[model samples]
Target: MRFLGFCLSMLPIPVIQQAGLALDRHLGDKAFEAQLEELWSAISTANDLVSKVSTLEEAIQEIAKTIEASPTLEAKTSEFIASLGSNQKEFSVLTENQSYQELRSSIVHADISNFVAIGGSTNVIQNSTVNSERTHLHATDNSKNFVDGTTFQGSGGAVSMRKITTQGQISVQGSGIGFGGEGGIGFGGGSSISFGGNSNEVSGNCPSCNELLRMDKRELHKYIHVQCHKCKSTFPFKLPNA
Candidate 1:
């Protein structure tokens, strides 16, 4: 019995199951039942270990895939950064080019032959010369007023100028109408009398009492003092060439 136990212990555990079954058939079931139960328990533990090892192998494969794609992701990131740097360098070169510098320093001359501006305010400041055939500005917006103050020493051609505001009074005061040329008339070519709207009539409200002051053709080119009838506050009203 001692020799049998020593020999069975020396054998592997898997073989021990078959050997114990054979011994049970030969000798009896009573002597080898505990050894068979222990062998079965060892087999269950080995099967569990095999299942855990299979799961561990799948996890290792996923980690290997991630590691293999890391270089591709890093390369794409580097390529994106390099593209931004290249675009910035190209933009810097374009801004520093000779043509770009010339465009920044060049003079812009716009030839507006026949121009008509309606419904807004326009300001023209000519230091040297302004040659125009006909220039007309009409302010149709009720919320704004048209105001023109031009001072020129010389002119080139005939200019028929007309400025009208829809809901505001027109104020024109300057030197001579035309400068340095014959028939260079200004502000309705000396035919217009009142200056407000297209109706050739000018009217305004008193600043003190809000009374309406209407201008007739007699009061067109005259420096007159108007008194508000409501509040009797007198104010000076002047016209061009008066």
Candidate 2:
């Protein structure tokens, strides 16, 4: 599989374009085309062959799965795979190799970018900001979620908020997973929700009194200068691990 990456990366620009054109002709489905465009883009710009190869290999596996869904595309898929290698022999090595097939099956497609995150932890999110972005947050696996000193527990728990202005803190712990975002905090065991921008918001609790402090949407994008009615305390909001 790596040898395939080396060959593909080292190919002349002309040959690479030829190969891309060949795949585009055969693997012309919209999905495959999008994947190919990304693959070629990565190949052309990749500075680290190791990382590039790793990423491309996963991409190839995904393309294979798409092809697998349409048995009629098998021949075209073969041709596309062949175009990746230098010759028929290399193509056979890629197609006939047991490890290569196993590698494809083993891929777990978890896409986490700055806009997304997933994990488990005993942690705190405090004194931070979650800017207006498309962010999804999840907390799972029987964990305790403490947002602004208010506890949200049990399964299927989620809080969706556009903006959060708080002088509060969030803590996640126990045998579960917790995902944090930029602006607000969510505590739960099985719920997942989108958090950010031009939507309704969930209020926070005062760190000193654990009283719900409703927020004003007008306060969005400003530094935290929240007042707690119960304890008469004022403080700022911080991001996870800040």
Candidate 3:
């Protein structure tokens, strides 16, 4: 029970002595003090109750209506104060389901120039959890997954974009975790990237017999339909990017 200290009346009465002596005669000491305490107590109690309740709209509003119908400032003040207190508690209850945690891990610094961000807007996740009540964690689970379990927003991921070297061909090698465009494999920049498991991108040097031709990932599957001019007469091989 926090005591709301007495507020001196803001109205400027004659400061000489006791200007309200006449009015004091009207309301006896016991009656005035008791009435003030009653109003204060009611307001404070309402405030406490509202905060604890799951739903405060009905209860607080009822108190407000009761105060409005009353024809005095003291009653209105009590109701307003009660409403304020109750609201703090009420909203706290509503957000009880929410959780907060600080993940403890070291930051990563890596070069990610090779990776490209695909076209279109990305998912804006307010919060994410793994196997928790909410639903899913974005990016961590799969590069393919986007907002609300929907497909990419216009192929919206590193899988769609590819960076062209100033004067070098894009290379690939079919090995661990497959390949597409290296996620976060740039000349310099530590941006997190995730590529598809099997991307169909092929490359080869033109006309230079001594030059190299290469393919990786799903291309490793037998009988590659390579649409390249220099590599052929259609040369068949395995583990080029390797």
Candidate 4:
């Protein structure tokens, strides 16, 4: 029994050496290794936390920027609040809708008159007065206005040039008539016929008369019998052979 106990206590050289190595490995360096591992784990956890927080903070800031940038949301919210607080109807009102449309239209279509350019001479004034179609005002030195077409004109631009005037006369006389109509005719701007105080014949007759009367070849041919409507007188208008 004693020998067995002593043998057990001494043990084998390989077993003893292995035991010492295990002790050194487990007890001696274990504290430092554990401490290093613990510190590394803590540092890793802290880094992860920091990364998560930074990501969260960036997300939050982005959300705030998005909110700030959204005009429709803010404007709608404000309008809703205003409507709720005021006497505004929940439904659309004509005036409000019109105002909204007008505001949007004004924003979209801003007038820029400076971009517009007016042509022609500024030295010559624009004639706003209405003129007869028969008359045309020129921009010459006299600004000579001429009646182009035949117009039975009295006054008030009734094809009489009572409206617009350049620098010359109120109504200019025309040259001649053209085409055919009810004792009246009109043509393009090129042709003209006009009347004045002196052009009017005052023989004091209604249907008037053609002053030029000459014997034509029709009266000399055969024995041409003609009856006058005024006197009912029948007369042979044939000339005797010489």
Global Cα RMSD, each model: 42.7, 21.6, 29.7, 50.2
Model 1, 101-140: lDDT tens per residue? 1011011111222111223322221111222322222222
Mark the regions of model 2 whose C-alpha exceeds 4 Å error after superposition: 1-198, 239-242
Relative to the true structure, candidate 1 reaches a TM of 0.17
Supply candidate 2's per-residue lDDT for 77: 39
Lowest summed lDDT across 10 adjacent residues in model 3 is found at 87-96
What is the C-alpha lDDT profile of model 2 across 152-188, one tens digit per residue?
2222332322222221122222223343433334553
Clashes of each: 0, 11, 6, 4
The 0-to-1 C-alpha lDDT of every candidate, in the order given, reads 0.31, 0.33, 0.27, 0.25
lDDT of 3 by residue, 1-242 (tens): 12221111211111111213322442455654565567656654646542343444444444444445556745446333322222111010000111111111111111111111122112221111111111111121122222111111111222112221111112111111122223222232222334332233345563424445433333245454433322223454444555
TM-scores of the models, in the order given: 0.17, 0.17, 0.17, 0.14
Q: Candidate 3: where are CA atoms >4 Å away?
A: 1-191, 194-208, 222-232, 240-242
Q: What value does the lDDT take at residue 23 in candidate 4?
A: 33
- Report residue 173 deviation for candidate 2 (angstroms): 51
What shift in Å separates residue 211 of candidate 4 from its native position after superposition? 14
Residue-wise lDDT of candidate 4 within 36-123, one digit each (tens)? 3443343334334322434544433333233345675334323322221122111110111111100000000101000000121111
Q: Which model scores highest in lDDT?
A: 2
